[model samples]
Target: MSAVAHAQGHAGQGSQALAPADPLPITGGTFKPTADSLKTYQTPAWFRDAKFGIWAHWGPQAVPRSGDWYARFMYVPGHPHYAHHLKHYGHPSERGYKDILPLWKAEKFDPEALMDLYVAAGAKYFVSMGVHHDNFDLWKSRHHRWNALAMGPRRDIVGAWRDAARRRGMRFGVSEHLGASHNWFYPSHQYDQFWPKMGADYDGADPQYADLYHPKHDEPFKGNPDTWYTTDPAFHKIWFNRIRDLVDSYEPDLLYSDGGLPFGEVGRSLVAHYYNSSIAKHGGVDVVYNCKALGSGEFYPEACVQDVERGVMSGINPLPWQTDTSNGDWFFTDGDTYKTAPDVIRMLADIVSKNGNLLLNVALYPEGNLPPESQTLLSELAHWMGTNAEAIHGTRPWAVYGEGPTETTAGAFKESAAYTAQDIRFTTKGDALYAITLGEPRGRVTIAALGRNAGHERRAVQSVRLLGVAEPLQFQQTDAALVIDLPARMPTRHASAFRIAFGA
Candidate 1:
């Protein structure tokens, strides 16, 4: 048998009896369920040049304004969210996540308005949460009955967002966090230890709700194991069917898995299917597949875009990557502190200089409106992007990432680093180079990377000007550093950009 045929035989062995209503249009490709097959993958140019994206990590979890992992966290007795749930609603034994679904009406969700703000804020692409670990589908699913259309919102949230994005000429993508759900929801089956009379079995013990809870009555509920995802073949099959349907319905330009490629060969098959489907739709493969690099041999940098959850790289990365971060908590939390506009701009410049993209999630209240502070941050970003976008969009990394004293800690969840005025990041476009100062330079700005005798300098600097300012600035190139005199007044409030022109 051929490699493709052999792979199909392996996938067919007890892999979800459920198949999509329509057959997948996989016409041509040698991408099979194997490491060698995936190694042939390559990232698209559209993603490499598009340096900024906005993500709506919004979902039913926002209904309570209670922060992230609410679905799982609410069942744990000691968690603050669980206490909030007990006070507002009843105990989990009476009310569960299923009961919280109807409250997420998304009554004020206006995708067009949000997309316009994102476009002005320099977002080249937009991503929607197809499903989080909550297992509630945001799109209208052919197989799953628990979705936005059937319940809370009574609307296809994903479809609406995609329409708005298409109208604005922005690429649309989706994120699936469902792979880790099996073990994530284990707490729902246990009863509270502190409360006396309320210590009855939670609603997850009912067999009627087993489809949603997936608890085996004969087995004991081991509340929250150190292991994250389940190793069950049955759950893998279910994931395969739901995710396949998501891909077939929306046909997104990009797909991101919250974890690494899941379920071994089953995950590889889905990835192959995604690439093939995109090739059929767009003539060639213009799609991107993003996943976390969990140090498994399966996640190769050449095959897909490596995503940092809430962090950045220290230096320039040869392959294009992405940083998925948020303004505050993943879900909207009441009275949560948010990142400043300058913080977002600085991170963007740093990531772009390292040949990476920034996918920022702006939190939205349960009613679907942004927080007042988030709105202010967006306005600030729009102003900065309007003038200095030429330095960001469609630019490549410089020979060096940047010159700086304050270095960002390189890893996931290490994004809260405080940058200074001396810290600078660089990007190049043809004959021009953009140097972004993390803060307002008070006196003179000296760039050692562009010094006269430094081999890093590509060509002689002819002139220098601030991005938003029209007047050219005075500069002196020496063996030690290229120093530029600044105007008495600053051009912008946030991070400033300086455009250095080079002669041929």
Candidate 2:
């Protein structure tokens, strides 16, 4: 159906204020605000080959180091974060979130240094959080006055990230979680029922700051199913305008929405405008759009990239996809146990073998420097990537993902798994195949998938060499299995990679 028709069909579900508007007149290509037209869109080659990326999920919320959703969660009367806020920053009515904004100075923010570390850590792309559900824009947004330039830090956060990524020759991306802001921030407008001063109004209820706090919603969103996105047409239009400003200004290589394509027709129009704008700039589209809604069928086959949050696909996907995960919490939270380097390497190997990229979010502290643990993690990742990067970058999924005893649950928020030496993943480029061992094998390792006696016809295995190791692998390929002798000492502390060459 046409975009207008689709809008009409779903109009009853949302406010009547969201009637279809004229499509934005983009200069370059013939992209209409319709599902059929967007079906012609294709994934960029740059995105397919760039297997790993780094995301700075940094913002004012990191200031307290109280973890994700601190802005909204702090307002809930009995929540621990609320007590923390009360103890530290006074009551919500007096020194609420609006007062907390000035404290996020980002005094030590150095994008260039961070970008250099990310480059060494083998990130081909860098994504900056344009805004979070706190309703704070990190960029120099013309549409929203409550942005980085207008408030705390007094710097163009997105522009700085873009410049650094460009200097490092990495593709730039921006993630927008603003689509869910209206409902997410609804708690701010509420009065605490069980506080020291019962029923005292929070700063959000003040009409003077409604733009930043968002206009008050009558219904509370504590356990509401529709809290993810707002049905209010005014907020939808505001969302479109803000995101449109982001696209028109930054022209990032990738645009990621924290949720699905937002308010149907309006969202489609923004995406079409993004593609058309990219065509105007680069003469051909070198852009990618990612959203976290699976099986919606709202996205066409080649229209955009699919993103799994903190999870992986079960096997090789027909089209390229990405997994956006963080080392710890999405935002910086004090006393959180982070993923070890070995765990990260294992995840990367598994993700790459499944025709998917891993966009790792290295959580930055409010002061803008990495914690000691995070710094060490990056250093270890860089060391591992330094040796086995050839096996990852520009490689496609092999015939089989791998021969593994352990498999992660295939869905969002399922990043926890214990991988053994038996867990192996495969990727290929031309005649060379990469077999990555998730952990160090005790003795000789055997790959049953490459055996001549496999379920299907197997390729002839010619020779094998371990990446970063000077010595060649002692191996034999039989009809039963392909066995290789492992050395006494591991080349790296993390996952090991082997380049197995095949014969015609």
Candidate 3:
């Protein structure tokens, strides 16, 4: 995932027995565990209007303070995390990921404090990690003992986050990356390639720790992405039960799967159960399920909200979607580069213009606190949002997304090129049309899409004003374009939004 944070539950007891595979857990509501039934899913308005969310991708992996895949990469021969782990925590044969779990004592983690910061930064929702690819649960997990409550911080990370978000009336969500954990942890089973203990099996080879490392599977050095998900039915059942407990316990407003619907039928059943439970919990179909289901980077609004990981869509989508990215790496890295406040603002405006939400992860250290740079970034975002949030929240994509030369590269994992003053995005709320410039415009600017003769939009603009400015702007609408004269000074440095009111 190459994120800024990583995973860790905690340590106290022996591994619990894997629960026997059973039928889908929440089969009571209207939806069934079939693709056809799920096809009728409708994205909730709360989610669509909420637009932006903050995520806590933080976990034990941050204990290493290195970037992503610490648990797995630490066992590899040549990866950077391997070297870092070797230097600090010894070789995998001696000190494996299991040892890193205890180091994550979230003494500084205050969910309410972080939630307040996010709310100020214009986040309408919050997502907590239920379990990460390292297969550690952030909640009180029943499937296995390794969890936030059982081991690492010995606190219910998910519960605390959920309570914090709910206290502030922000919607709550959970992300489960356990589908690929079985294969992701395969490296732990192998030995160091070149070392004082070259062929010695890592701790993962021991039978007693199988529950934490997963039962020994073939070393998965295959570069293919498919290999990430194994075909073990028992593992699927385990995933189902753990996630079911997560859903039933939290009854989250949204549920996110790291990858596409996992294990087919089992995944579908879980979605159905989630939808059913969500209806009962909220008294309507007010829940959203996000998955990276299609390989083509297409959004399946019919089944679930499409989630593009670390990237964005090429253009406006017909239905609501999301781009889950981070200000820095997924997990916290000691010397990581963070996205600038302007960069984030531009991305948020671009994403919202394309009918997508931005779920930004603010990387946190193992101590459960944000770095000063992150706090400053959030402050910048809060300032910008204070003036321009009306253009973002509760708005839909305009007839045309916008007139912009800067285009976000299509598909997942691509962060897109930098935007320019020429790049513009559009959003609409009732009779108000918002034209958002990704960069600080010069003294004057022209928008061809708003031209009177433009075929896409023929609405007559009655008045025009900048979002934060008190005075109405001077503008002329013609067949060629709508040209507006700008004030010498703009309110925000990140982006400028012009609100055009259309009269009947």
Candidate 4:
């Protein structure tokens, strides 16, 4: 079967067995705040004002030659990464993820310098990985002994990043991929189709790393073949406790979960704790939560934002949402290809135009520093943001978000055909309207959709100016459309924006 078919089959079986209830629960003090409620949730002014963010997907997984889906690779039989794991470390049973922690030497990590670079690259906020499914905390946690400071790195990773981000005048946040930890880690317990072929030493009989792998308990692994990890009640409690400690200790400006909200009631309690803690810290209400799963009817409706992965929504909503995507794989791999700077800039403009914030992009640094190619991309992005920032930051969707020939779907992880010259995305800042061209127009560009019928006249184009050019350009308005003359040569290589001043 194709990967898509496989995914669909997996989804069908999973949903058939378990019907997920309305994940959103109404907690006593947690009242749902709409966009209008004085207490109603409004996208935090800061998040709206600061349109772009960068995420650091660093963790113990970086220690190995394997990739981001280490949790999954441990189970897949005869896969290249699986084979690498067997040859290099033994089997999933022995030399498991916990044993890999000691090998993670983030020796070159410099949070201050990294945050400075991210800020220069035009990231308004920084998201540091708090804990991935590997169950290692990147912070100085009082709850979990298996943390960065206590183990491999021997430094408070999150705290350092937070301090650096704050010093650079950027909002700081943490990402918790621990929600599915219980299920994602299940494969470690059972002997998979490939497990039997492993040599005697490859069996998970090693006692030294038992704490890391969580020695098998009495519970029977469940119905889902796709769920690799076992969920022990005791381990679940520890998960919640560790996350609670993270929220309380850090009081992050934003909190991101890998999956939607946490798994069970334990997860809900953690969310409640995060909301309450934010209120307590900011003195009434201050922080924002970004969850994959959005809940309804809560005191802190505005307290959280929805995170869409690599996709833009069709229409604008009063509430703000974010798109989190990476330039390449989440973890740095030797042969990985990366998205170009233009691709990054275009994505940012497109996402912002569609009434969403782009947690724009990230590239993992295996050696604790950005590779030269990644650094070059960041520099180019900074230049792009510098020129077209007004069209991006602090802007909302205009009446209709521009006319375009190539339309992208409002679904998750959808890749679009390359946008053509006819495609233009629209955004507004104060009284100014920005029409960003996805591709360069050959002669003159005409926006016929802006006629009087659309409640705006062609005369509304008071003054037209190309973003990267110095002088204003000549333009004319007919009854149907506004047309602007172009320079003999385009100013920028890829996409460009035009600034239109209008009298409202």
Candidate 5:
């Protein structure tokens, strides 16, 4: 039988059956599951060149409309999600998250329309959530019965998204937060400590729901970020099997792991298959795998680009990386504040200038449609990207990322740094250098990195022009700074880009 068909067979098996502890051997490829063999992998140009991507971090969790990790926290007493669930749906013992599954009728879901908006907003790629920490799959799953196709949307959400993205001439990706879900969902196994439902076990405590909640474990979920992974051999095999199924089924251009390469060999084996399968399918090593740092000692940067959650790199990194963050709460929450167009544009400039891609998540309502506010935000993003995307896509970092008074904190998990008019980020494309200002400029803008004495510039600047404007702006390059006169009226609000061309 064919490889994909063989995979479908394994996936079609009941979820109660587990794969062997030692995952199947590496698929047909030069790379093995070991760290040494996988070191040969490289970041694909498609991903590096596609500086910005949009992610649909949507799933059954959005059904609550309470924001991120609602399924787990809803079972934890004293948590806001618990209070919300209590007030709206009754106690967890009677109405568990499994009940929330059928309520997520994505009737208004229009992936094609959303893809058009994302492409227009300068997103070169799109990501669909294959599975979230809620332990619910969003696609047509052969392994799990509680999936979008069978329960909620009754649609192949991932397949729909992948098809739309491919038709629009954009790369497609899938993110798996399932690795940490085994432990992340442990909260559901506990019983309420207080009141009417006191002593009544949450639905997760029942043996019947073990497949979804994960068999009651010794570890109780406390919502700790650092301690959300499991060492249990049984869970390791399950995670390995499920993720392998996802890779084989979709063959996404990019595969994202919510955490660092998990469970040692189990995780590595899955990545090996992902890479090898990409080679066989596409006839080239054109695929990308994204994950977070190990948060400690050495990590395999050569295997995959580091994925920073809701954060950024301090400066230009030699290896390509990514920042995955949502505009608002990861799930759709009513009345949640969102990032503005300027906020997203400014972040794209800084991230790209630092040799990183911005994988932004625009949360979707439970029905698979974007909120009206999100649509307006996308329109605003389209307008800005339409005017200044030349500075974004297919660009590389310059000598210094930028010269700015804004102090930047490096590493991962930090918020986007604030910037001033002086906070200019640099990117080079062919013969041109694009200097983008984070804040609006009044009269004149100076780029100190292009200065002679600053030791960053190589040749004399030939001409300088503001993007989205007609005429070239007058500029002077001196030992101290490269100064340019501003137009009487600004072309774009929040930020602007200056295209600087050097003499031959």
Candidate 6:
């Protein structure tokens, strides 16, 4: 459980130096539990059943649609966002992320109302921002001076969302992007690649914002030697301290680290503390710990989940994992376009079929409230979720996910060209099978993977019902596949779910 950074030493270079002390060992047991021990974590049947979760990428960063971490943007010189920053707020020397905090008035933010809409839209769980790389705590923090309570929204953002989500009978969680904050804010170097032509020494002369964007030193970046940022011990200590405060304060049921866990023994200790504390509360209640780079072969055996950013894995595994994405940019902008409801639904179906969950999706909005277009998309998703709740909410993958000509890679951040109507993702609930169509069929649909003539010869069509439709539809099994007559109009516009009952 050591948070040792994986070092790739050059031929001439000596081995990397170890941290002063070893990481705190994971307590209670050494044999990391597998999927069989999931019950010990108290991962509810509902969560395993509910394959989809929603994330609120909300933060002061959302106040500026220009990009993801405005904290880092202000530091790099001559980047597009840096120029944007210079145009809007003064230069990085005069105005910093700390200054932007006050402008983040969540005046239109209504957690209860928003949670109701999200749940109705089929989000079984909600993850509020605990802290991002900006180093600003979303909740009222006992340790951090920079937080939502003292400045910005002047409200306990995460606490309010947690309370609202719990009240709505939905699981509540918190996301911590603080792991990358240490290197991300490395004072001596401008880490952004977008401004390579501007040179790295641009921020060195800024004395006014030295504390906000720490002053750089002569040393090389510790994490990656070739990188510009330095992993100074003092800065790492501060990062760990802030994260410790976050874990102790919120005790979120699910904790998601932006990248991986922080970079040392301190990070391991923090993880151990989070797990142990959750166990102490609610009598050993299980919780999920999500991260991207868990380190090769260094997996958390205690029901911890891995998150793939903006992509789906090809092969299905019994272990539960998640995928985080957004409809558009992570931050909201005036002219930003968003994904249509159909696109979102299709993505969800494909992900579920691959045995993964979707998280960290935000319908970007300004002034802390969703726009009318985003609201319309959520309403459409709600309609789809209502009709296909059986297929989506509590289902497991069948023997084979489905028969489809199209393929989506299991790599990180992979995007699909387009899904054809012929593609169908499969999930199972009890004795019934749910075939989710990726897109609307032009006319007749046939699944080649199911086997031609096999549907009519061996598989009997017991009953076929289109999701969201009141009337049961008749279907005939042919040599190719089960073909059900479609209504003149689609039940739900985006992707449709069909509940096929089978004899036990």
Off by over 4 Å in 1: 1-28, 217-226, 295-297
Global Cα lDDT for candidate 1? 0.82
lDDT by residue for model 2 over 198-290, one digit each (tens)? 989988999998998899885333443334556677887898889988888888999998766677677778888899888877887889999
Tens digits of per-residue lDDT for model 4 on 96-175? Answer: 66777777878888888888778877899999999887677899988777888998878998999999999888988898
lDDT of each: 0.82, 0.83, 0.84, 0.67, 0.82, 0.67
For this target, which candidate reaches the highest lDDT against the unseen true structure? 3
Question: Candidate 1: lDDT of 300?
Answer: 63
Would you give me the overall lDDT of model 5?
A: 0.82
RMSD of 6: 5.3
Model 5 ranges with Cα > 4 A deviation = 1-25, 220-226, 294-298
Worst 10 residues of 6 by lDDT: 6-15
Local lDDT at 501 for model 6: 74
Lowest summed lDDT across 10 adjacent residues in model 2 is found at 1-10
Give me the displacement of residue 357 in model 2, in angstroms.
0.6
Task: Write one digit per residue (lDDT tens) for candidate 3, span 68-151.
Answer: 888988887878988898899987888899999988999999998999999999999999988898989999888789998888
**Which ten-residue region of model 5 has the weakest summed lDDT?**
5-14
TM-score of 3: 0.94
TM-score on alpha carbons, each prediction = 0.92, 0.93, 0.94, 0.85, 0.93, 0.84
How high is the lDDT of residue 251 in model 1?
Answer: 86
Off by over 4 Å in 3: 2-22, 219-225, 294-301
TM-score of the candidate numbered 1? Answer: 0.92
